[model samples]
Target chain A: MNTTTVDREDLRTLVAETLDLDVAEVTDTADFVNELDVDSLMALEVMVVLERRYAVKLDEKRLAEITSLENAHRLLTEALEKKG
Target chain B: MQTTMASGASAEALAVVAMVREVQDHRGPEIPLLLLNCLERLTGAGEADVVIRRPRGRRPTAQLDGRTIYLSVSHSAQMAAATASYRPAGIDIERVREVRNVDGVRAHITGFLPRHADATREPDAHAEVLRAWTRYEATVKALGVGRALVPSEFAGNAEPDITFRGLNLPLNLNTATLHTHRRNQHDSYLLSVAARPTSNVVIHHDSDLGYTPANHERHTS
Candidate 1:
């Protein structure tokens, strides 16, 4: 079991830095594209950074799932659990 | 566009940018329908039986009398926009806000935008850089390669107009039919469009988006 546990704050900060957003703005429900206006490049950058840092493969379809802090945390948790 | 242009019909084409206003939810189905209505108003395709196929997150294609027209849509907050062209088209709209962490060119690939030496000293530098980002983005999306954003290909100074207007500086790729036309609409939003403009591309502003059913009725009548 790869007991790697990623917390919400850590994931939020990672996403915030990647998207260049203020940590407060990347709230639980803010849609990356709709609300924060994060373009595809920004979104892809987050994916690349997360995949590299977490050492997990994120599919393009799953890429759509990581829109906000809440979902991102869930996705990473699921990916980490599966990695084990 | 430092990266090559997307292949389609770029010659002698009719490019149009249409705006939809007061859209409560950009993700709702009504957004596409409203944009389709705008397309109908521009192309007069209402005369023929048209069929449109729009998958989520994909550009919608409409077949009218055996001719295919490409449509690209973008929305921000309460406003939505759709760009149509006989050739491959891509557009993006953004609610312009503060630009941050603009350390340098590579640091802010979307907007390294102090085009000239003294340009960065301007007070509206943040907004200007954000505007530059819009042009760069719309041009890339026009490539039709779906979600392809290459930072190294970005050119801060392309089709440099060097003027600040309702529609500010044009983007890099200036060709016969297609390039990018960007504007600051409502003083708080930025819009950019890329299409084949060989046949006099026409663009409508958000101000005109209030085009109600009566307007359409009068046009068709």
Candidate 2:
């Protein structure tokens, strides 16, 4: 995880946009896989967006742990910290 | 019935393809049924009798007669393909398209460049990138990790540190056998399969799945 903090809303927007859903549909507790129909390929795309936006090399293991919006935000923050 | 390709190092397994003529009506909710339909046709199992198990903390499996069957599936421009064997295997296919994001590649995926400083001289860099991408995806799926794999893992290391279902496994590319198949002279599409070391796989294309609704009905009747 990085030291830089990612705004929860910003992360939600990224997820929503990548998944082609409305931003309002992305909630903190929403499950990306179950609720949004994200398969393995889509998950990879999400990680790419996150890596590009944060400029941080994310641990693939940790990225796989992101099932919900809340977890994604937390993971981004931690990955940024590690980058610094 | 269309094109069929069959070639393998051994007879241990087979990869099969079922043409999906119209995907416009086959998106989202229909994908699972589509896969099952294809599998049923290939395996001679009725759609109701084909058992697909989604075990927690494990790769999904399909079974018949209490025996485990190795399986992997892929979808490309006009095909829904599946591979089955007594040994684990993964397959992937991609329809080549225009490369609009060349700058995106150089910026974000510099890993595509050769280590040599003269990589810019390489022609058709776009197609090469797609080839690498498809191969990487096939490798990951063959490893049973699917999208859990990081793309950069293939960049710096031949052996990737892959963790699946909480188990850290060392993956050695040298030990696995990968076969690449191409369709169309212009390279309009490509297919690749990766399997366990020394395992043999036979691949069948859209025309060879042996799906017969009339024959299946007779068996059930």
Candidate 3:
């Protein structure tokens, strides 16, 4: 399995593509809801993708605390770090 | 007051007590109160900082320390969904009887459902719908975004299995585990609990003081 470092921009692009939203709408500070209009279902979808992409598990309670592109990026990074 | 159990008892072996009060049946904020009571008993803290959301126009409330604990509540069936997480959590219990325009919802939130549309065409279509909806709901609650996130933006490729006519919806996450129970025979209400990856989970029935008679005796003795 390739353990290459996954970049934040890559996650941003993936999220944008998966959700079919404009990439320009997503920013480090953009709220998943306010900016991209992500709902509960969409959030879970992103979660599933992250787990599959990174091969990491996210605690639901911890996932609840994430609210933005930046938050997701940070979490994915932490999960990757733990892997290393 | 520490309730002493039998010597050599491990904390994990100790039964977590839960209190269930059907205050308003389907109307009151009984679940939150039950959770608060359980937390109070479990933690032995008279009152700690807590936040609760209820269905409808109820506002979420919190109290620092008091016999009559304050709870902020709202009425959103969406809030009751459960997701696998590191913490012991609660989910919503509602039986959805119909599918309201899946095509429209799909257009908006395609990522939440499975890729195989045939899976949704079984005799248990209603159950599948509820299962999918609840899984999404539970995930959102676990994530703490509640209804703040739109239904359209959830995205993922893996599809979880739906078993028992919607009794189970696969979470498809590496870290969390999903367990569900159907309380009534008609399957009118579904309760799902999600927690971190653990070998075994003890489901405490609320009315039984969160203990089985066997475990209670084991602890009391």
Candidate 4:
């Protein structure tokens, strides 16, 4: 199986599409709750999107740390590596 | 007369009177934070900050100044509310709107219903479904399980010990007795409050507490 590397753009696109914001607006430094105006449901949706996109299951508690694009990319990469 | 009533009411009784304020001016996503701020001021929890514990795939619990205070927040369309009390409580408010197709939503909730569940079919099934959804949400909320609890878990003996009441929040000051009436659709939205060990749930409107509604709109996220 080919290893698909999760990149920053992939995480940014997912966040932008989940929140219906412009892709340009989802800066790597932006906070999910403070910048993207995400409540708990939206946050969960972001996780769900990531899970489906990567076909990898993630513990919800860990998603708490994926509050920014930078964080999301790092976490998703780690999860993918473990899956591989 | 004032002193008599004040003396008669216990601290817990006073806490039973939860505040349900509408901070519609704030954007939808920002309402929860505003509600916490409002709750802190109302409880006189000075210098106490709001904290939330987010469990993945579940609703988070709101804490005030490190103390566990029962809080339920809901927002739909343009309106938002924050319900705060000393006891375990849950509040839900939904915007009443026409749904062209409720079959999918109903199917999702069907497993939660008992075998002998009524309302198998009706003219107002859509509206009834919305009401039921709110009650279920409020009940789970009061149970402190939030969405993490499944409908099947609510089956039989696993049911939560909760009672719901409906209040008509007036455009002005008003007082109400808790658990007096089963929740009914109010205005354009459905409001429900669920609490364990049902008590006289009184709604203390902002004006009743000398909290002008304008104060709610003053804060911005």
Candidate 5:
């Protein structure tokens, strides 16, 4: 388990609330666009929120490649860890 | 202003814009001609370089210049929301007349509607169907691909919130953005705009361009 500055659990909750998805269904491998069916506009909204919460600027191209819950977790963990 | 012929890559790459105005049920061919004329004036392109696709009877028509200037005109008011991005990019507007139950609709067409869309207030059945249809059409238009690709191919994919399956589309095509704008006129209309990412988008009222009020209606219910 990667303990980073950004809490994975919190991220999951945010995703669920923002996208109106079942929190339990969000898995590490669940792709936001493919598995969760989150639209691009919503995705942008998520990015905006994440930036404000984490104080990090994610690259647009990089954000586009993140598909599953696991990918998001890994990216967030890595980013937060680097910030520390 | 007299039409002047200029020679250069900038002039050659210019996009030919077109418009069609239906006033008092007087649908004249001149609307499209004037639109093309305006495009010619805007881009300084000659008729030989422009490609016009006008469908017979009642259908959508598109004018294109290698994905640079793609213009699709539809008299249907339902199409207004989809055309808000027309100034700098291509737009496709559509209106739905029916939709199935939300649960069933998502079960079958989840790929088309993003999760956020599901969370948003469910629009009328027809409106929901129209939104998805216009988004798909706008994506195709932005890619400069005709209706050759199977709609099912775009059914299941995941990446960005907005995804375009360019499986067989030309290599030059990249990304497409979908936006919906509601117009309140004689009835409600939705417009969708699709264009290359490099292009800028500008939305203006018909009145702003000196178009007679009788031709363009207010965007309100």
Candidate 6:
């Protein structure tokens, strides 16, 4: 039931659930660290959850790059493309 | 950024001293007075205007005149600590408490820590996890890479113990010696000081300055 496609909206929904944010709050361009006040622990949570959801591997560099929904969408797309 | 006054302290008195001040004010999100005070001591620019730029999510950095001052800060419960140095540094203070997500904590430790080290061996497991968490955080802050840049592996001289203050051990990482300490009592809070090297850490209580409601000030900007 938790599996999601590589779509940006789906990715946003997954991150919103992991960070306990409403879907509307996770705008595509919003900064997770600055605007949302997401800490390192929460950042790690989002990474682990996303990796599990998409069956893709994300290194720490990629994890740090997930600063915004747009950045996350691009990173996840790249990881998914690599898996294909 | 905020403004405060610091008097009667000479930063030139010692070249290597990193004075860390702990302020017990849970009044608001940002404690400006403590930061300004620490900056004054670190910069030796006593009585001069100190402007600190605290960009959200990164360490609070100070630019006095032309040079950049490196420092790290951590806040929990009613406590906020800031330490400044001529070199890059970071600090973390955690209020010792029970952790709800034990498995999640373990996952974080195992994510980077050595697999051989037993993260959950026995008594006071929560404090060990807290120490592990803070060690990495202080390192990240010291490196000034922000939270998103945690290294894949860390081999600090930290080990698990079977006591209430078991996490109270100084970690000597490859480059920096971070002191993990417990304040006042075993149940108070766990503090890790990477503000200075092992030979230079001198912790000061804001309470020593006759800390009062009127002394500690704050602002939104």
Which segments of model 6 are wrong by more than 4 Å?
A: A1-4, B1-32, B41-44, B47-68, B75-79, B93-105, B111-130, B145-149, B155-190, B204-221
Docking class of 6: acceptable
Residues A25-82 of candidate 4 have per-residue lDDT tens digits of 8999888776676544345557667777788866655645768888888888778888
The CA lDDT at A69 in model 2 is: 83
Candidate 1 lDDT at B102 equals 36
Residues B115-214, candidate 1: write the lDDT tens digits. 4443322236555555455555566556665544344335343243322222333322221111122354443555555554332344454443322111
TM-score of 5: 0.41
Q: How large is the interface RMSD of candidate 3?
A: 9.1
| DockQ for all candidate structures vs. native | 0.13, 0.19, 0.04, 0.06, 0.02, 0.24
* RMSD values, in order shown: 10.7, 9.9, 14.5, 11.5, 16.4, 10.2
Ten contiguous residues minimizing lDDT sum, candidate 5 chain B: B212-221
**lDDT of each residue in B1-221, candidate 2, tens digit only:** 53323233434244333323223333454446655665665566776776887666455567877776656666554444555555566666555444443444433333323444432222365555554455556567677876555665455432222233445433211111112233423324444555554443434334423322211101111
lDDT of 5 at B58: 23
Rank order by TM-score, top first? Answer: 6, 2, 1, 4, 5, 3
Candidate 2: Cα lDDT at B186: 31
For residue B50, model 3's alpha carbon misses the true position, in angstroms, by 7.7
Error of 4 at A24 (Å): 1.8
| lDDT tens per residue, model 1, A1-84 | 345588678788888887777999988889987888776545655766777778886654565566777887778778888878
Instruction: Look at candidate 2 and give me any clashing residue pairs.
Output: A1-A78, A1-A79, A2-A78, A2-A79, A2-A80, A2-A81, A2-A82, A3-A80, A3-A81
TM-score against truth, every candidate: 0.59, 0.60, 0.39, 0.51, 0.41, 0.61
> Candidate 4 — which residues are off by over 4 angstroms?
A1-4, B1-15, B18-77, B92-116, B119-194, B202-221
lDDT of 6 at B37: 66
Worst 10 residues of 3 chain B by lDDT: B211-220
Number of the candidate with higher lDDT, 1 or 3: 1
Report i-RMS for every model. 6.4, 4.6, 9.1, 7.0, 13.1, 3.7
The prediction achieving the highest TM-score against the true structure is 6
The best candidate in terms of DockQ: 6
What TM-score does each prediction get for chain A alone?
Answer: 0.86, 0.88, 0.83, 0.88, 0.76, 0.87
